[model samples]
Target: MSEETFQRYSAYYDLLYRDKDYETEADSVARALRAANPNTHSVLEFGSGTGRHGRLLAEHGFDVFGIERSQTMVTTARSFTDDSAVGRESGIFDCVQGDIQTTTLNRPFHAVLALFHVVSYQTTDADVDRTFANAARHLSADGIFFFDVWHGPAVLHERPAVREKRVEDATTLLTRLAEPRLDVDRHTVTVRYSITAQSKIDNQITEFQEEHCMRYFFPEEITSFARKTGFNVERSEEFLTAQPPSDRTWGVAYLLRKRT
Candidate 1:
């Protein structure tokens, strides 16, 4: 959560996630939330980077408020929304700058969401538990919480040790490299990023680095944690499916309801 990291990558995030289809993912998450608690109207989105998912939820008729850790990301998100006609027309989006573990809002929401592996960014059990507790604090009675994270089994199996890629547009070029570190006892994976970008005309290259650590929990462990946090531990499934999670699943998505 460094300003330098976000400042370096703000312009590239949208391009990197262009194929992610957050709108569809948000719809899927919203559907699950609605099924668990049909009366949801207000939503608080944690780690809402660049507001991609938040915008989608707002357009779908939820009053969406976003919390982001990076001011640069929030600034870029604000500009992106400002430039969009749909965003201007909807007017249901609000962005706040804060960390997921410590941020406070004035009012509770009917649903809370942290999508696109944001939950994985918590590298330790304490961090993860604190984030869940914070989410619970922001939930109204009978509110539901939804989030997705990288499945442990998938990470251990894939064991992505190295990757390199480049992206270019008319005006700029971006180069990215990823190195993975595994902490088996903790079931956590940390990816160190090295990014270099250059302007097409000036050819001025800037380099930056960031580390993203994601803790992978067993499905039962997640359920137990949710229960301890006063959630009803509704169910969890492989991403985008109703099927039970398996070793082959790359991610797990959860639906937890506030104990009424």
Candidate 2:
């Protein structure tokens, strides 16, 4: 997705995904991180939307730093603080605005994460390779690089389709229509989102459209990319579950370790 798309999408991101179980997902991530590296302490998260996962990971005893491409999202994420009893004045989690493919911190982390199909957003070969390289660059030796992506076999088997969702909060009603156009050769599905939001107080309606091109990946390609980027593919399984990838699984997670 482009920065412009993110700018418009950030406003309603939390509202749109309010029903998503971020806690459970973060728990799954924490479990994976711990199982992969028992001593895992610091994490660098790519595409950390609103710092929800980051905050939960911090609660799991990890110092989390998030890199988000959208400045609006970074600002919104920074607004949230740690109100816990062990409150540190430094805040809960930190987020910076930067692209995953090129951003560099010149620092190493115990774990690197790019959740929520952030890899799939890299629609091109160069983008995907550079993203992998970036992850490897920031990771400590023997550290884990965990990420989820659109499974190519499943994407091809089930195919993309049009879908609509209606969600409302106390003050507003939001309806979103997703229309997908698939390109087999590119292994991409361009989903165009048409959202209509209505304010309950004045009954005012606002509509907007955004396009997101998602790339699906086969395990062989992922392994190849990992090898080229100085990583060994440690595990490949369904996200939040240890099931092997198959035509039935759309979200597949891969755990990779930087070569020592």
Residue-level error in angstroms, candidate 2, position 218: 0.3
Quality of model 1 by C-alpha lDDT? 0.81
* lDDT string, candidate 1, 1-260, tens digits: 33354555666888766678777787887788678877888999998898888877777777788898888778877876653326544537678888889999989999999988888877677888888999999999988889888887777777757999788888878888989888898888777889898889999988888877667877777887798888977878887877787777778988888887
Cα lDDT tens digits for candidate 2, 38-115: 999889999987888898788777888999998888888888744421544322578799998999997899999999
Q: Estimate each model's TM-score.
A: 0.91, 0.96
- Model 1 poorest ten-residue lDDT run: 82-91
Question: CA lDDT of each candidate?
Answer: 0.81, 0.89
Which candidate comes out best when scored by TM-score?
Answer: 2
- Model 2, residue 202: displacement in angstroms? 2.1
